[model samples]
Target chain A: MAHIHLGEGSFPLWALVLWTLLGVGLISAVVYRVRKGGIKTHQIALAGIAAAASFAIFQLNIPVWGGIHMNLTGLVGILAGPLLGALIALVVNIFSAALGHGAVGLLGANTLVNASEAIVAYYAFKTLIGMDWDVFPASASAATLGLSAGAFLMGAIIVVSGVNGSALPRGDLTIAVAGLVGLNLFAAFLAAGYWGFTVTGGAMPWAKRSAKALQRGVQEGGGALVELGRGIVVAGPIRKGGLMVEFGALVLVLGVLGIGLYVYVDRYGGFEDGERPAR
Target chain B: MTVTTLSNHVPDPRLVTAFAEQRDGPLHRVNPWTKIGIVGALVLAVTVFDRLALLAGLYGAVLVVYGLAGLPYRRLAGWYTLPLLFIVSVAGPLTFLEPGTPIGGTLPTPLGELSVTWAGIVLFAELSCRSLTVVTFALTASMTTKYTDVAYMLGRLLPRPIDQIALLTYRFTFVMLETLEDLVKAALSRGANFSEFWSNKRLYARILGMTMLSAIEQSERLVKSMEARGYNGDITLYGDVSRPPIHELFVVIGSYVAVVGYAAVAVYGVRQ
Candidate 1:
């Protein structure tokens, strides 16, 4: 459910081809892995439900907090594993493009972005739960990490897209777009943090606990360092984005700081009317 | 074939499909593949040209073709206004925000001298026009061609399971959307209505969960029904229609000439 506001001609053809090729390769690998069991009827059915569910939830931008809306990208990963999650993400992007929500040219790019989030969330949640972290924190952080990666990639694309069509290299627009992405990334972090606690706060029957020895180690000392190490590893990387991508991160972080206020981009970014207006 | 479309409100399901089933003319008469080629060439031409005048010229030419096809201007406006605004959101600020060598006038800002670069002004127009042209071209293609037919053509281009997955996804999205609309109504009726985003977060999650559960149940039923009908798990979403008998050579040559010539102008003559 990663909705980028990018349109046709936003990207240079080479970038479009490169990202698109990478996206197709990933989906192909997933498809090949699943097909090893044959096109088992049940697997397809399960994939269908996953795609349907994500599509439905994505369409209805549920008003959740501060007039903001949500589509349950994180929950999709938790319920469905990496392969089906990516499949659902691709389907969601297809529908979105047909409905004029995003550019068809960006189909491959958008799919990769959503798949990244789903994959990140799935592995992150599993690892966090294994470590006996509270379900809320684990799931939310997992979700946040997925979405943050998406934001970064999207920002980088927007920045590089200027080279494709603009005459003088519109660096100011690039900065604004990058700044907007940064703000969205920050929002993802906050939302995941808050959503995690709210969902798993007291205790759920399903929530598991860490082994007593592991719990005791956490209570002793140096537990934070171990957790921090895990966080760094789980952050992961899709591919080496090189220097231009690093510059995108610089724009996002530095722009947010230089503004010295809540970036106003939230007001004008994404699908302007993503949440289905009450009918 | 039925198709899924995104909109906030319901309309005739067929209308939701991007093509007009009844209209017959130059646009509709043109083959879907040619339309795809034209769009690809035109978008590429715009991308490499980097010329505002050339972009504007291409955009006007596209509109004239749509006009010749009798597409209502109101419909064009309805579909493309937000996308146009989104393009502005990216390119609009460059009208004033860019800093470079002064073209004419300069203003002192907190940071330093703020001057409107000739480059920035041209960049803004080029990008805005490029974005509009590409978006309009996309809408025009969808409006004039049956997407299922295009998918069938694509089915021939891609591998087997990928095509199967694509058609299946398209078919099921509508199924899911109906289920979703019904669920939202039921939720509201039961006073589980969403008010604030945060407080009702759990309610939202519950709705999403329920939707997925229902989709799974629906999928099981659908599979059973499909199996009963002797469905062999092939990607057969489209039905047979005779291919149009028109020769495609002219379309190929004309499109190449237009797109290539346009691009050549940018390569050989464009200053920016």
Candidate 2:
């Protein structure tokens, strides 16, 4: 879900070397451990199949978030364990890059992003299961956390590497990346919350009812606004229609406030075109 | 779902394998190692040089090589969509934010003035060239190199169990893809609505979860079959990769030397 789609030379040479070295170091450690421990034949089979599954799914575009793809690295971690899971991340990224889905030069950075997802998911799931959580909740929570960690790491990499031609300063880039990560975390949690809700068969009926009421109220308010626009105001107490008017006013005020804030920043914020501001 | 929508822009692994096996092109005959070495050199060249002219030249040469390999230019163009999108998303803002000789007069907005800069456009072009060069060559290599050769290379290049896993993964990826396609078909047949993601998130999750479960079951069967065939932990790849011919080796070495020389000159300016 969180993949760096940057091109070759997107990062400076030093960043490229640093990320590649770190990626290689991690893979080396994993390989050394695998060789020493001597993996069972079944485990080997699982890893291969898991890699195949991950690679296949990586290419798929689910009709979510305007056709986004899911990594399922968390599931790979849970099933294949961390060691093989990390290896699977590398294999998947390599195959993906070869097919032009990701940049070959950024393979090292991408592998780290994905491998961390798998490793974190594996440990999180284990800990949750150890704490006597159910499979559905444990897996869901772990996967969410894993994806959030990957998103955060991806943002960190981008900010640290810094886009070669971007005009934004490091501080500004960090803020932008932080906002992106926060949005990703929100989406992850939303999906997990929905999953939990459905799996538990409407565990929070009151919350569901509240959502339905809000939706209904919004719809009714929209209808009332159209009526008012047509000069056919109903002679009744304020209801859903009034709620709609209030919501519209709130949105208008917020929009104005946002514009005001932007103007303030433009005038007061010490930034110049492609140049860092005086601290 | 239509096949186009099901697969999107992803290159069919089966088609890639078929091309490698069936195409009797000059590229197919060339050693995979030589192609890989040249790709490495191209990557380095793109990384070290930021000049638009040099990057453009490299891109043109790569396209020529791709064409000479008898690969389909139409498909190559189609594959450019993702890389181009990436470049645009990253470089688009720079056109306004970068300080330079604006191509057009700046437009005054409430917040600030926005202008497209020559430097920004050059940066965008440079990135596109760098990205597409590697992407085109990679596709060419994968399409030309046989699966067995790729497996052998993986075996030789990667460590013990990882190599074995990669080999098996490569072989089974097609199988898993077919399985997924079937699953999608079944779901669509049952009146599944995939267009509205928020409304059908559960359905999407179920389909993916089913694919995972299918993979686990398939792996169990695979393990049993391997055990029956007297399989040990190691899965050896059949056939050995031939070395690049001597002349090709020289070209590869020369490319490396040229890249190194260029990098040295770029980093430490040449003295008179």
Q: Which one wins on TM-score?
A: 2
Q: Indicate the docking level reached by candidate 2.
A: acceptable
Instruction: Give the interface-residue alpha carbon RMSD of model 2.
Output: 7.3
Q: What TM-score does chain A of each model score against the native chain A?
A: 0.65, 0.69
Total colliding residue pairs, candidate 2 = 0
Residues B178-211, model 2: lDDT tens digits: 8888877888899987678767766666666666
- Using Cα atoms, each model's DockQ against the true complex is 0.21, 0.25
Please report, in order, the local distance difference test score of every candidate based on alpha carbons.
0.59, 0.71
DockQ of 1: 0.21
Off by over 4 Å in 2: A165-168, A179-183, A190-279, B1-5, B103-114, B267-272
Name the 10 consecutive residues with the lowest summed lDDT in model 2 chain A: A217-226
